[model samples]
Target: MNVLAFFTATVQTTRGLWRIGQTILGIIFRHPIAGTSIIPILSDGRIVLIRRRDDGLWALPGGMVDWGEDIPSTVRRELMEETGLELTKIRRLVGVYSSPDRDPRIHSICVVVEAEVEGKMEVQDALEVIEIQAFAPSSIPQEPMSHDHYRQLQDYLNGLTTLA
Candidate 1:
């Protein structure tokens, strides 16, 4: 078999086992609420990333959406709040992933969006982000992602096939 097929089969087998474990554990514990994350992109092709406050790891600048808020609005608001940039365009909706143990606090439905920045930004949320940087897609970190956001980044960079 080809490498892609082999990798996909392995992932499917692993995810199947993970789901079974989740079913057993969920009998006693409840999952956490859902959240959102945006992969902000500049017109020049640079992707926006932030240094997380809790850990000094880099990730996309996004957070949970408020109750009753729309996904696109959440992306726009998050981009503005975290990076101080207003998005000119919010791209199509990517796919959703729920691996049961992806998040430690709760089961989060991360709504990811690709967007283009309209202008410059100055990060306003001083507590959540330590620094903001724009890097080419090829320069992203390989491991130790801030909060599983890097998974979304990987999905996005890999033609967004799985996540889109």
Candidate 2:
């Protein structure tokens, strides 16, 4: 590996690297917008979920933020990109989830937000999503969810916020 890549990886584990990301997010993205994920709740009290085309596992519809994107905008953009739904109300920031192993990629962080829908919901990103449906929170399938999406849902269910 290149010396700088090796150095950042090595030094990233040092005591303050953890907070560095939060600090950077706080400064640049304007609220520690580590990354934005969204949980879209429908009017019937069911939450919208989707199965990834690549992995075929259910997950909340979201993706990485663009370099200059803010959290709120990123959440909206990803919601539209992944599920074709627009967020009308950001109920709350569900939490932040970042475990080294939570994502397959290194140095990747995710922010989870819960939102209410204002318009129609549809499966638009057919290339990236295989299935879309509204599911009761109580009936969520036990089958593994994509990228620890199940865990994020659990965190919301248990009223746990700000996971790291």
lDDT computed for candidate 1: 0.73
- Kindly list the per-residue Cα lDDT of model 1 for residues 1-164, writing each as its tens digit: 99987876776576446545654554457754456777888888998888878788888887665558777787887788789999888776555756666655456667777887867767666656889889888998777877677788888887674542
What lDDT does the true structure give each of the candidates?
0.73, 0.76
Backbone clashes in model 2: 0
Candidate 1: C-alpha RMSD to true structure equals 15.1
In candidate 2, what are the lDDT values of residues 1-164, reduced to their tens digit?
99987765565354235445555665565442356678899877888988888788888888766667788998888788678888888898778787756755334578898899756777765666888888899998675888878888988878778767
Give the residue spans of candidate 2 off by over 4 A.
1-33
Superposition error at 26 for model 1 (Å): 13
Q: How close is every model to the real structure, measured as TM-score?
A: 0.75, 0.76
Q: Candidate 2: deviation at residue 109, Å?
A: 0.9
Where does candidate 1 have its weakest 10-residue lDDT segment?
A: 19-28
Q: Which residue pairs in candidate 2 have backbone atoms (N, alpha carbon, C) closer than 3 angstroms, thus clashing?
A: none
